[model samples]
Target: MDDLRRIDLNLLLALHALLTEKHVTRAALRLHKSQPAVSHSLAQLREHFNDPLLVRKSGKLELTARGNALLQPLSEALGKLNTLLGTAPFDPLQERRRFRLALSDYAARLVLPDLMRYVRVHAPGFDFAISQASRDAMLAQLADGELDLALGIFPELPQDIQVQTLFEEDFICLADKTAVPDQSGLTLAQWLERPHVMVALRPDANDEIERALAAMGLQRRITVALPHWSAAVELLPDTDLVLTIARRAVGPLRAFRQLRQFPPPLQLPKLAYQQAWHIRKDMDPALTWLRQVMADCCTTGMPSG
Candidate 1:
């Protein structure tokens, strides 16, 4: 602790720049300092840590084992310190910001259109980058700061993640109209017998539909397994593949006149679609505004199919 107190914050910042840039001149340029000043800081850092944090390897600067170990935590600490001390009143119309988000295609279909429209008119300076991944991967990305927010069915989560319910949805069966001409919906036995198209993002992960069936000592044949909701719905036309998917995902099928939606034959648990982020971001004004906008998009009569 005494050693830490003796170290200057500027020295830590210099170390971060050095480890990141891997060259004294580059680190100096990044820190807007003279090369000699940064070199002096590095020497001080090495003496304080009792290790040559950076070494010349293969004729280039490289991090030693201890330096490599310090990079991630040091980066995270600097980030938190910046957030704590550097935050300013966010102005959506003036501040240019980009957010990274993860969500299923269905959630994107439901929320993004409205969100985009609003941002275009109200927060034109804000930008978004979106990606799709499995639930576990999304959670991992959130923890690692790779993703700013994720929207999906997160039934369980770690303590460090904060979640807010956007909406609640349940399963509906979508099938080719020609395949189920009855229009009255299928009986439980008939539903179980038909080959199903399952939207399993991870090949090894079982979905809620499978879990519900397993509780009743039943299993349905999965004729197809794929990760995408949009593609899965498209496959229903001119085929016998029935997709047991979230009701919200059915909105796009309005264009697929050949597809018909039916209530699931058996009761399934309600799916709570949510937006999640690392708790470390809770105090971020920009993210707070974005989350509220998303919640408004969900509640303000966006199509629920």
Candidate 2:
């Protein structure tokens, strides 16, 4: 702690610039200071760290072992500091930014159409790239900076991953009208007797519906397991297979005249669909705006009931 007190915080910036540029003159140009000023800061940095951070090699400067070790941590620290102190308001109209996102196909169908329309009219310069992955993979991607945001039913999360609840969704049963015959709903016995179509990203994965059934010592026959919600719904129109899916996912497929939706026979926990990002992006204005827009789209665009 005493060592930290003796060192100047500004010298860290100079050290970063010097190590990044590897030349005092170039570092000066980056910092907008004269060559001598950067050189003086470099000398002070060497004294504080007790290492010649940069060394001359064949007439060109290169980072030493300690300098190389410091570069990534120093860069990340400085980036966080800049985010902390920088408060310039974001202008979506002028800034061109592409955000990478991960979400299930169900969420993509429920949210993307509305989100795209809103961005096109409001923030034309902003763009999005979408991918889909499992929950654990999504969290790992968020930590590794591979994905900027993820939207799904994130029930459990790491401390460093921030989350915002977009909306609560519940299960609805979909089947061919001829298959069920009853327009009201299925009884628990009838529901269990039917061959079901399970939508899961992983073939072996058990979803909330399966878990809920297991809790009651009951399990249904999943004749077909698929990773896509759209494909699963399409199969329901022709076959006797029943699909229990999120209510929001049913809105877009309402045009399927042969399919009918009914309340699930058993009570299932409401799914809180959320958007998650790394804690490092908490203060990012662009991400903040994007999250809000997503929440708004989920609220106003999707069927609430």
Candidate 3:
């Protein structure tokens, strides 16, 4: 008990990093310490535990049985400690941090440009890496601490995750000005007859549109499907096809294309986008500031197009 009390707390943090990464270099990177310093800490940890916490295997580091045994309890304890300490009183302007984000295409368009601008003005050294995967995949990454936050039409998040509604958006029709010929709203008959292009980020993404049209005993003729939003946009300029996209997405596309926007002929359900994080990060001061940045950016840039 006395020896436990005397052990430095930072050593525990290094141990947690080492267990998580199973590599000295990555653990050092995570702890923001030099590799040699982390190596020394690892040696101390070995002495304290009296076991080879990590072992070389096939030219890569692997956690030993003892290290694997320590991972879960250590992670839980550190998470509690982090929540209690509140992340060293975060100062965004002075810190060099990298935030990994998982964003839907709509959120990226509505929030990212403005977010980047704000970062340049206030937190120059802060950087962001964005992933455009489906919300479920991103949320999984968030739960594992591989992603800092995910924002989009996320659903069915785990109970230990927390979410905040960022904004609500409605769908709008997009088409090339020349191909569409008529800038006025598409009639129900015309909308049903025109070939539709789809952005297939999720399998049921068009369900809302389909349900709305089904109410009128009408069906859309979706002739082409693209996996990417950019590809969907590229298709519009030449084909006599239209795509219904979230309101937040259209504004940013205007700088690139002269696309015409119209209200969807069908009454589509509103989309609520949310930002989600693991409960473990709920008290992180830096993450709190970033969520606020996202909120502020969304408020200012809510789809004039």
Candidate 4:
């Protein structure tokens, strides 16, 4: 630890620059120092590590075996340091990064399209993997770095997990146009009588609908239990079923004329969709950009109606 503490931060910066540029002159230019100064720094780095971090081959500088192994890890460490120092500038248009995202199918449907379109045009080469996992599993994934971000209605997480509310929406009733003659408003009694598609995707997810009903000594006849909202909308066209869905789902689900939406008369709590990340990544430039893009997707073009 003493040896680690004695090392100069500037020297490590020079090493990082040298490893990245592979040329003493270019590294010096990157560091805004003279070539001789950078050469002196490299000499000190070799003495400190007791290895030739870079060697010249065919008249061009190349990394030695030890240096080659350090490239990836060194880059990652410096990135985190940059984030910590708050000196990293996020250039989404030029950054090539693939982030892992965990989201419900409904959020994927509502958020991904707009998010992709924004980055697809504004920031080229950005890639994402959208996945679905339970909140506990996803929190574990975030803690372990297997996932970069998660979006949905997650419970209160540990301190290590950071959450940002993207938007809040209320539950609306979806029914086949033909199944309900009155499409304007659905009363509590009407909702109780209809056979419903119970969207119990997870133990905690959307269970509020049932809880609200139970509070008033009522329960809808559950006709089907599916893991995703996509199926519930599909069932509405052919079945006499009512689906209490998030307001955001109304836009895409509205595409199916067979399904029409009505505001349910239950005083259910508003559903808040959020983005979660490990607290460690709160300042990461790329992750911050991704979060902003997601927030924009949730808010744009959905005025009060």
Candidate 5:
């Protein structure tokens, strides 16, 4: 058996390039080194492997039987090394890397438009897929690298994950403009007394709006319950009153040109919408770019209280 520790890293790279391109000039181009440099490395690999890894056949370079057998493992090992060294440059503008984010419809509506605009201008080639998943499932996907980010009001997050506050907003009332004296604000008492539309991804015990209301010795009269925030906006234009979620959910409703915002009558505990991701990716260049871009979009597009 060969002493693996005696192996030359550069020879392994040469072997990989040779197996991939099968031609000296082409492999040199792939390595961004001169043809002579690649040829020299190929000789070193041949001596190390004690076999001609590639041979000329019908005027084209072809791999030997040993080379053919070594290809898969060699490629896999080189790939592991490349990833560890972060050699694969992340080109969001050209690389079709897909990112999945788990967020509620409200958060998506609030943040996605701006996020898309940024991608169009900056990372035009990258794609993002957002899905509404349960908090547990979302966290699991994030931890397992199946999801890139989660945007919502996470009351608690795993210690292995890192959360950054995007924005904090107090609860507000959404109603027809005529319902409120001034469209700018509402009193807590008015919010408690009004008929509200409650929105949630699924039937859950802990509702942030309700919790905020209860802390103030008040509770909103939730006349209707819906699964998504967009549905609530659709209902807002026809009805005189409904509780419109503040921060991210407000702009989408106003775009429909029917609802107005009011300061809640009483002080409701402000909810902090955060962006969470795996701690392992904290220093990754690609992840950093994504985090900054989304965070910028959140701040620039969503109304911060």
Candidate 6:
């Protein structure tokens, strides 16, 4: 084991190449080393292992007993080590890399459209895919490398995960224009009494807006409870009542003349939605670029809801 440390790492590469090719010239070509260099490496490896690793028989190289036993495990270890070292670093525009983001429907409506616009204008070649993951699962995905980023209120993030709050927004009540009396407004008490659409993206805590209603000795008569804002929006036109949602979620709904936004009745603490990623990926260049792009988009590009 002590002598093993003295062996050159490159010789192990040469040995793996030789075993795979079974010919000196072919191994040299594969390794981009001259045949004589490969021969020299073979000699050195034979001396280190104290066995002729290969022998010529029937006009082809045949592995001796030690060589045959080493072939499978050696090949496997070298393949894994090579893959670990050979993982190409990510480059944004030049590389056609795909990033998967885990976000709730509301976040997609609030953030992604503008982020996509930015990507289209700047990093046109980059690809993105989005999937719905509950807060707990999203954090897990980020840690596991299945998700590149998560933009939402992650109150339960693990201590090892890194989170950066991009912006803060408050909740707002949205209703069809015609639903309100005089197309003007309704009191906070009146708003709570009416049927409402609810979003339960955070399974553990009741949304702050709901708590505000409860403090007033009132509770929303929830007509719908959905996981995504997009789903909530789809229900708006069909239902004749108010929808409780984050202010940022209304950015993409400007085209809907039927929906009118009203400030929440009682003051609710602003929702601090953040971008979170695993600390392991913090220094990864491609991921760093992605974080910067998203942070910029959150700060400047989109209109605040």
Q: Judged by TM-score, which candidate is best?
A: 2
* lDDT per residue (tens digit) for residues 1-305 in model 5: 26777787777877877875576876777578999999999888888889999999899777899988887787667667668986767776765667888988778777788788777777787778878887777887876667888887777876456888988876656777666658556655665667878787665545776676667666566687877776776676666566756655655443766567666565557888888897545545666788887788777762222
Off by over 4 Å in 6: 1-91, 120-125, 182-184, 201-205, 214-218, 237-239, 252-254, 302-305
Q: Tens-digit lDDT track for model 4 on 171-245?
A: 888888888868685677877888877665563444778778788887778778877867667777867888887
lDDT of 1 by residue, 21-84 (tens): 6779867876899999999999999998899999997997888999888877887888788878
Error of 3 at 36 (Å): 29
Query: Per-residue lDDT tens digits of candidate 6, residues 56-148?
Result: 999978778888787678766765775698777565567667888887776776678888877776678889888987777888787555788
TM-score per prediction, in order, is 0.70, 0.72, 0.64, 0.66, 0.61, 0.62
Q: For candidate 4, what is the lDDT?
A: 0.78
- Where does the lowest 10-residue lDDT sum fall in candidate 5? 296-305
Pairs with steric clashes in candidate 5: 185-262, 185-263, 186-262, 186-263, 186-264, 187-264, 187-265, 188-264, 188-265, 188-266
Model 1 / residue 258 / CA error / Å: 2.9
Each candidate: RMSD: 7.8, 9.4, 8.2, 12.7, 14.1, 14.0
Whole-model alpha-carbon lDDT for candidate 1: 0.85
The per-candidate count of clashes, in order, stands at 0, 0, 0, 0, 10, 1
Model with the higher lDDT, candidate 4 or 6: 4
How many Å off is the CA of 162 in candidate 5? 1.0
Model 3 clashing residue pairs (backbone)? none
Better TM-score candidate (3, 4): 4
lDDT of 3 by residue, 1-305 (tens): 69769789999999987876666886787789999999999999999999989999899777788988887788788878776876566677888889998876656766888888887877787888888876667876875678999886755666446888888888889877776667786887887888998776764554567767778787778788665765676677756888987765655675646678888877788987888887556557788888888887777652221
lDDT of 5 at 32: 88
- Taken over the whole model, the C-alpha lDDT of each candidate is 0.85, 0.85, 0.77, 0.78, 0.73, 0.75
Q: Of models 1 and 4, which has the larger lDDT?
A: 1
What ranges in model 4 sit over 4 Å off?
Answer: 1-88, 184-186, 203-206, 252-254, 301-305
Lowest-sum lDDT 10-residue window in model 4: 296-305
lDDT of candidate 3 at residue 256, scale 0 to 100: 45
Structural RMSD, model 4: 12.7
Greater-lDDT candidate between 3 and 6: 3
